[model samples]
Target chain A: MRINLASIHVDDQEKALRFYTDVLGFLPKNDVPMGEHRWLTVVSPEEPDGVELVLEPDDHPAVRPYTEALVADGIPFTSFAVADVHAEFDRLKGLGVTFTQEPTVMGPVTTAVLDDTCGNLIQIAAMEAPAS
Target chain B: MGDVFKALADPTRRAILDELQERNGQTLFELCTRLISKHGLSSSRQAVSQHLDVLEAAGLVHTRREGRYKFHDLDTSPLRTITDRWQLPTD
Candidate 1:
């Protein structure tokens, strides 16, 4: 089955909109209103026709504790694959995105973690093996 | 916020953070109840306590005691710093 949409819970939809678009550089794809919350979604600028990232509200009572436990244990809520860990790290750092981990190579891959500000720790990773 | 909140890079911690954010001052027992009922997390107090220790060490969570009551408070300045960076000029 092909993946189409993935959702990330946010404390505030507006904040998620700004952070996902401005800091992470994703483009807003859908903004239809859904009662108190909007049917919001974002797409990578490079993949407008590809997968969409839905910014859902963390209104459910369970969301806070679910996210809090993960944060306390130093685990990322989710991860993103980037072209280059070092470059993306520096780029995000330059944009004032705080990183919990630096680009550390682990065999064939490298990874780093950053706070999403809307109550999530997001990891950006990349493959590091040289092409033959 | 980066160094102090390094442990905060986890979603579970973010949720615990909400407890502190909402109540500002809570006992460990209160935190446990919130985690179980609110987030549906089944972690025991010991497991949740460990998370608090990490946050406490990072200065993101502070504790105070008045008489027999022990309270925990969340410091959001560091969290605010993260959002500050993303405050780009909106069109």
Candidate 2:
């Protein structure tokens, strides 16, 4: 099954916006006001033109604790795929991004873990070879 | 919480599954060292085994015994159920 988009609630919408758009290179897809907070989203530059990442505010009871726990532990809410994880890591590094983990080979894939610099650890990975 | 979503929710678990997706069978220690080490936190072999148990219970992953080690792999069949829940707008 395919996931169209993955979303996580943020404590500060504006910070989340800048991090996702400016730092990660995702394009802002929508910003709609929905009560106390707005429904903001960003889509990947490369896509089959599928799901956008929804930057939601962590105010709802169902979402607040989950987001908080992930942040406290530096665990990313989700990860996105890349064609070349090593190149992506280097490119982001040149842009002044700090990575928590460099790209390393793991079985049949090469993966890298990085700090989103926004209270999350985002992973970038590329498929290496077909499974045996 | 529902098992499948719970299995998919955590980034570490997701990474482990992603690794397995590319290489269908992997030892818990290999997954732990590759996926969890970057976070500066390492899950023990027992903990990884437990996570595998949780995934197996959720029907999100499958395990096979190879020699003395158990290899874990992604089982995307349950994801079809998750996909069915989301209805895309044709209009």
Among the numbered candidates, top TM-score falls to 1
User: Which 10 residues in a row give candidate 2 chain A its minimum summed lDDT?
Assistant: A67-76
For residues A64-118, write the lDDT of model 2, one tens digit per residue.
5665454333345577888889889988999887654467785567877666654
List where candidate 1 sits over 4 angstroms from the true fold: A129-132, B1-91
User: Which predicted model would earn the best lDDT?
Assistant: 1
Q: Model 1, range B1-91, lDDT digits (tens) per residue?
A: 2365476876667788987787676556557656776777888888888887788877788877543335678976666666687786778
The whole-model C-alpha lDDT of candidate 2 against the native structure comes to 0.70
Superposing every Cα of model 1 onto the true structure, what RMSD results? 16.0
TM-scores of chain B alone in all candidate structures, in the order given: 0.79, 0.77
Candidate 2 Cα outliers beyond 4 Å, as residue runs: A1-3, A60-74, A129-132, B1-91
The lowest-lDDT stretch of 10 consecutive residues in candidate 2 chain B is: B64-73
